[model samples]
Target: MRFIFLVLLALSIALGLGGWSAHWALDQSAEIGTVTIGPWVANPSAGAPDADPYSKARLAKIGNLTLGLGEGVQFTADRDAAGRPLRRECQYRLAGQTPAARVWTIAPYSQEGRLIQPGSGRVAWLTSNNLMRAEDNSFAIAVGPRARAGNWLATAGTGPLVLSLSLYDTPVSAASGVANVELPELTLESCPDA
Candidate 1:
């Protein structure tokens, strides 16, 4: 009877630990196959055929259509330069030059992965072709609930927000790992609530 009880206790401990570990792995926001550059994080291998089990599970759970290895890489930022969580009530500026790419897009989305629609007649996303660049080719985009003078990306409602920067037909995708690429910096401009 003593030996049987000991075996049962060991089995229970093993099962409990196993279940906890599996849950922790699946719940991680930044999985193993990911690269972080500044405030942006990208899992280049998430869409590859040989992606790890965790990467595949994360993609499946999020229901995101990831860019293929040869297509491009999509970087996501949920925080500002100071590492504060991005909130819709605050204003921000995305300023910098992107890595080499045939085309790139910057858009705002809710934490649930849905696009955040702005007021009618206003653009909620910006593309590389239509932006006004500085003399040196750098660009600045204003993001907030209110409208700005130039290169504006508007958001609506109040909640946590995310920024998605998708680079298409870029050399970054062809590389095995992320190179020293410069991505835009998201700086908090203002917040009425704060």
Candidate 2:
């Protein structure tokens, strides 16, 4: 019995030491994974994988991420029948329900995951209840070069575009139900077509 107890105690101590070492490595800047969105993926040659999430030298910045599409969501920019890229447009659409605890937003960003900037990457596409609603309770934002009628998502000078929908204040457990939501196919539209 004593032999068994000692063995178990040694195993526990080894595990605890390993965990602490990992934590220290992360704090000291470890490497992490690259950011990928469908066919468009960013390979960061510099960032560390085990680095801290809050560190400035981390892999990539995340402007938008979807949480409510059943389990997870898939996004592609809306494309024309010819498979051509649509500008000031959403090629991919994620259909999911937002959690009650926090607010959700679908905003445009660049391949680097930074805010698209200047327009759709601006304050228009990214909205909350603080902004005025347009008739329907559902919020809509447009992405493009010039300002449109509804929410204006400014695309600075045109690069690959991506949309990130975030659900703040949501718990990890509640996010599991997202797999059950019957999401709609992402629609292709210019500024107002969708």
Candidate 3:
């Protein structure tokens, strides 16, 4: 009886410590939501340096909790090289090694937390929506003013873009995992001239 009681006490202490550590690490990582771009870097009414203005369910993970945001990264737009409302064509690729949930989505958002001027151009790619799918059942999306046709992610004529790849329904394993996850990089192709 005494041996069992001691083991239980040790397990409780270990769990408590692990949870506390997770919160601390999260607080230290840079805020992924709020990132801004553009010339002058001052125009949006909300504020300069646009922060993460998108509405998304929190991210989840499992295992070591290591996430991969592709090495190639692209930032939001404020102005073009010529300083005339920058525009660009780009693609985003997302993948997960062991996600807790089976479904996921990549949605766009503005600084004010609203979907940009609605259009079929590119709204939300959801598993249930039955749109995005790769050969292996993974997913990818393209973002631009014009439509890429399939897997297109639409953008407003002028404003910052917040792309959120949300993992549906947080998984219990991820909650206990101690690793990071990865996100796709935004590949910029064509930016409007100055």
Candidate 4:
């Protein structure tokens, strides 16, 4: 009876610790090296040898090919500038001067990391080569489930979505030591029902 009790106690402790460790590993958001601007966050070391364990795990989970360090930086926004979670129920306007880069692209993706497909003639992404810029070089793109006049990114379903912006061969540095690089602005426009 004494041996059985000890074995049971040891098993309980092991199971408890295992559960806690899995929880932490799955939900850990404290990326070792990341740059945040407004709602967008970029991790420059995603594919590098020095990447953190969390980043490696996340990359494996997402199954995304990370760009090289000089090749580009990718930014993802799951929230709005007002600290509100980004939902497909609302429309948003993304406008601003992008950082210095050879090329860039922005796309709307569902929570599962798949591209959101809305309707015909409405693309899910905008590339730097195809954008219609103003005289001063600033650009605006509308993101919604419905069609808009200019530069619209279609969101197929309702619920939370993320906007991913990738800047290729950008002069902007993603290192933690660098400071004050300009990123695009995402503003909540309106919600018809909510």
lDDT of 3 at 176: 42
Off by over 4 Å in 1: 1-23, 174-176
Instruction: Please provide, for model 1 over 31-134, each residue's C-alpha lDDT reduced to its tens digit, 9 standing for 90 to 100.
Output: 58778887899888888999888888777867878899999999999999999999988999999999999999999999878899887898889999999999
Note the residue pairs that clash in candidate 4. Answer: none
RMSD versus native structure for model 3 = 16.7
Q: Write the per-residue lDDT of candidate 3 for residues 84-159, one digit (tens) a residue.
A: 3323333333232324445555555564435455455445433435655667655555566666656666665664
Show model 3 residue runs off by greater than 4 Å: 1-100, 120-129, 172-174
Instruction: Supply candidate 2's per-residue lDDT for 23.
Output: 62
Model 2 lDDT vs. the true structure? 0.45
Better by TM-score, candidate 2 or 1? 1
Candidates sorted by lDDT, best first: 1, 4, 2, 3
Candidate 2 on 1-194: residue-level lDDT in tens?
A: 99999999999999999988766765565324323333222212222333335333332333333233233232233333334455543423333233343554556666555666573234635535553454544444445665566555566655466555444444422224433432223334544443
Predicted candidate 4 versus true structure: per-residue lDDT over 21-117, tens digit per residue: 8668756765567878889988877767777788877777778788777788888999988988888878999999998889999998877788887
For model 2, state the Cα shift of residue 172 in Å: 7.2
When 3 and 4 are scored with lDDT, the better candidate is 4
Give the range of the ten consecutive residues with the poorest summed lDDT in model 4: 171-180
Number of the top-ranking candidate, with lDDT as the measure: 1
Question: Of 3 and 4, which scores higher on TM-score?
Answer: 4
